[model samples]
Target: MGDYEIALGASTFIKQAIDLRPDVGIVCGSGLGDIVDLVEDKQVLKYTDIPGFPVCTVSGHGGCFVFGRMGGKNVCVMKGRFHPYEGYSYREVARPIRVMKLLGVKTLIVTNVAGGVDLSFKIGDIMIIEDHVDFASMVGRNPLMGPNDERFGIRFPSMTGAYDKELRAVAHQCADEMGLGDVVRDGVYFYLAGPVYETPATSRILRGLGCGTVSMSTTAEVITARHLGLRVLGLSLVVDLAPVGQADDAVGPTHEEVLSVANSRSLVVAKLIEAVLRRITV
Candidate 1:
């Protein structure tokens, strides 16, 4: 618990200074930082100033920790995230989840911008992640690859029910009430170790493995949270569609594209998150 102690101490200090003890923690992806704008009476902390917090290097990621009221609930939100592609270890990437747990956050909501592997998906669509295909573990890299911290969780934690089904059902119901029933999708997300976008063959392989969407992050965080007995909810914004080897000159997605698509779909995502917050008893 030494590492966790150092990380948690720093997070707790900041959280206390802000006078915010939230029941919920949210990690916003790529271009989804705008949700912080909806936070009332917000307190913002820069990641660089937080001890043990990894600085975000990706564009469109606003690296800040925000605490405030959303949908009548106090929430702590990470406006950006650490990635393995930025040279951080899996444990380092999972540090924020540990910090959230220490800060008394029982529920975690994670979001990401991804490429649609399912033909039915379109850009600007939102998918509720029911399950994930962790290609990172398949290739021998995992956030839980090191010594297990007994204080944190066991050495072998079951991920069979990583996502909270009840929360997902509530989210869908909220979306339907908001007249977005047709746009909410539910499926498996494929996580790859990528600073680079997928090749045609990689996309095909992921599709064959039943991946609905593909992204470079999320799996590590989910694994860490589930291990710690936290309820989890995941959402993905479809930024681009994976080309099925149709065109060599296909215009692959860029960080800019991800931000644009996420920006366009931010309202719907924000509404769903807000509704979930309103419904949860804390």
Candidate 2:
């Protein structure tokens, strides 16, 4: 729940976001910031300019906010995401969602660059997150740890439909229509605390748990968005093919590789999102 301070802080982004009257909010993770550039008539605001917004301190993240029209609907975009590995509290990591809610955002589109733990996944692939294992929430570091805020959501909300089926359908339809189906996947995302890439053993453990993709940021934001009653749509760009079982089974991932993959594939990723948004009624 947003207390006075949190809610007040939201006012800053809200003041600017209101004019746009955004119904959709997009949080771009890692190499996905390019979507902000594709936004029509976009207005860019640096994270430093937004009061109470956490800064993104990683490579490949743009650390700003972009507002614009997409598919005839006003949208707000977080050009970069916050991470606990960057020393941000869970609440801080989720603040952007609260601000979006205050601004009347109804649907959240979250994108991340993930390592593919599922053996069948490959680099440059896009995985639509059908479900997730939120380590942060399981370990009690959830952004919603404090007292519940009814204004944001109920104390115990059902996640059965947290990620809207219609939105997922829209994404699938978009991918098929664009001939991007070959690179698209649907699976579960796993969240872990990471400044370092996971070890092969860890990858095996996650794979055994049925994780298709692994990310450090999106789940917290997803939980926040759901808590605020926003419909969620998550996608992970498979930048690295993780070593799931073998000892050093896969090639070690470098930030450079992740960046290159994301940079090169962003055009397609952007297209998928754009096409989906053009069809999303909410």
The global C-alpha lDDT for each of the candidates, from Candidate 1 onward, is 0.87, 0.84
TM-score of 2: 0.94
- lDDT tens per residue, model 1, 101-159: 88888999999999999989988888999999886776758777867788889888999
Give the winner by lDDT. 1
Off by over 4 Å in 1: 247-249
- Residue by residue across 6-96, what tens digits does model 2's lDDT show? 7567656557554676889998878877787678988777888777677778988898878889767789998888899999998888888
TM-scores of the candidates are: 0.96, 0.94
| Candidate 2 ranges beyond 4 A from true positions | 1-4, 13-18, 244-250
Question: Which lDDT value does model 2 have at 71?
Answer: 68
Query: Model 1 — which ten-residue stretch has the worst lDDT?
Result: 243-252
Model 1, global lDDT: 0.87
